[model samples]
Target: MTLPLSDSALIGTCLAATALGLIVMTSGGGGAAPTPDTAAQTETAASETAAAPEPSLPFGAVPAAPDAVDPEFGAQVRAYLLQNPEVIFEAVAEFERRTAQSQGDMDAALVQANADALFNDPRSWVGGNPDGDVTLVEFLDYKCGFCKRALPEVKALMEQDPNIRVIIKELPILGPESELAARFAISVLELAGPDAYDSVHVELMEYEGAITPDYLEDVASDLDLALADIVDLMESDAVSTVIEDNRALAQRLQISGTPTFVMGEQMIRGFVPVDNMLQAAAIARQ
Candidate 1:
């Protein structure tokens, strides 16, 4: 008949089995059988050896000797684990829960430490409700497919909830093209204004073609902004500073991918559905 084990008992049994295996493996096995005379001599030698004083150890430490493995106990542990495989799954699930909770706590601390840079940076464009109770920050690269996919979901989130403030951080990690796109966007924000930057931001998110000077010029022309001035300002110290600062912030927050969202204290590492976002927002509000 099988017997159930408590969580602590189960873990203890597994640990004991591991230690037993190590001890059994290290202890030499299958020695030749001793003759009657050899057994008598071995007993005499053991008596003399026991009578001798043990050498002194530093710090009055006692010698640690591994215990002999109980074959019956090892068999029982093996049988229990095999019969109740669900226990392993339960243990794994519990481990994952704890790990996720720990990571969430660390992310919350990180967010709190860098709240001003994340939520109130003057360089980044602020959309949705600026005075909203809840703030959502996104670190994105224009060339990332996930970022493109996330744009609509973000838009829908703002539309559905008018009180949600959104902050955009340009993190161009894809390549030079992504960097150029970000530079152009930052320049638009600095040179023109938020309205112009907002228009260009959407256009860039929606644009499927390659990001080139010609394409950027066309975008500027459409917005009735001077492309020459934008181009000149794109490579300036002001634009470089924004990108550098964003990269530093991302490194500090351990964000290595695009479409990473910080909704309140929670950090969503990748693209998630709108419902999940709303749920996170709701949780954040509480």
Candidate 2:
């Protein structure tokens, strides 16, 4: 049996066979020299060649027998790719798609691994259904615009779906004032209660500028909560420890941005439309 030849080997074989054919043609002693009629026939052949159909191979490739596939096939593939460079873009797109799928899978696994800290941390403020079938844990910073945007969506979700629980984890990475704001929110939630905490949370989240002691006092007074008492609670170890624990939990879940939402086995980073959030909650129920 004949061994299968590589592209390069097949090309070499074709070239050798061509050279042998040429040698035999040139050295044939029985052949007569071309007459005027033969020369006329040669001219006719050259004229006919101009009208021949284009080869199946791309332009610029040397014509070869069908069996010539060693180095010649490699060359053909290279030539075809050079002519259509967009193939590279298609390959890159496929790679990115696969990478995104893999990352999503990994994030899901990580979320499952850290479910206890993510969904049931006593420090996190649990809103919506206290015993809801699905829990959506949000990592938030008061100063994050996206987080603020998501607040209404969170509220709407809770309103529309009474069985879906929302867990708030304060991740104050914006600045010192953000930390203070988170500390105060956590403090109010821990010291006063969820109702009071919800009031302070909405006011703080809606406030425009810097969150100072005087500003917080005004907000506290509006809710009939003493600012001094809230400040004292904010400064205490319990509130600080809870925020620190949340930070640690965020790190474990590979969360690096605010307004991240985790539910079921999926971790959604960045702000998404309310429809998508609702869809995620629905998926969790299934």
Candidate 3:
């Protein structure tokens, strides 16, 4: 039997033990004899724990207790995620923030690069008048709320500046609805003329919330346009091809959002003031 050490002695003993541990850890004696066995055992245990996986959805964040889509699948996913819900959520948020930030940074860099490729492509710019002195290229989605509100301003800009041409590149990076609407709009461009495209463009932007097939059809009819023609063209691969092209260009240019404007060499984003646009357009003419 051993007598209990004084508190000071015990404290000194702990520090010595810690120092010894540090020495062992740093000097490679950590892997000697039984230490190697323990290290391997610890590594194996960690590997197994990683292999086993925690709950996927994390604690309390599982979609539903009894999932309709394969009960086993939900359970397995949740189990894979485990009690790390906060970690998962934070990870996702951090990823999005980082990705958006990186994209924003890359966008500035890419826009400055010599045009080996282009965001809208030089051909899409052809949508504007062939000989127009000033070209205004817009990277827009049909579903963006801000784009709709800015329609009057867009129209005003177009009206005030006749020589200023607008290139409406259907960069539908928002969601499925945005893509569909953009496709439909492009098809409508084929069905009708620039007027119809502009009318439909303005109308769709003015609409609030999610755009559906039925509402889209109604909007087309309201424009005194032929729905059958637009629908046929919308279903065609041409729309898909154009959108794919737009996505490629956006990826190259790093345009992640709607209503990004390229007036001459300047890349102005969002709903810029009309006065600012007027200033920019005037400068472009020069």
Per-residue lDDT over 43-154 for candidate 1, one digit per residue giving the tens place of the 0 to 100 score:
8997999999988898978898845334345555556755765665577567667978999999999999999999989999999999999999999999988899999999
Tens-place lDDT digits, model 2, residues 31-88: 3345688768867986888679765877788876654223333444445555765555
Name every residue pair that clashes in candidate 2. Answer: 6-70, 7-70, 7-71, 8-70, 8-71
- The most accurate candidate by TM-score is 1
Task: List clashing residue pairs in candidate 1.
Answer: none
Residues 52-140 of candidate 3 have per-residue lDDT tens digits of: 95657876785656313232344444444454434444554576678667755665466668243443354353343546687777778
Candidate 3 at residue 190, lDDT?
73
Which ten residues in a row are the worst by lDDT in model 1? 24-33
Candidate 3, which ten residues in sequence have the lowest lDDT sum?
66-75
Instruction: Note the Cα lDDT for every prediction shown.
Output: 0.87, 0.79, 0.69
lDDT: which candidate is best? Answer: 1
**Local lDDT at 127 for model 2:** 88
Cα-based TM-score, every candidate: 0.78, 0.70, 0.56
Error of 1 at 145 (Å): 0.5
lDDT for position 184 in model 3: 83
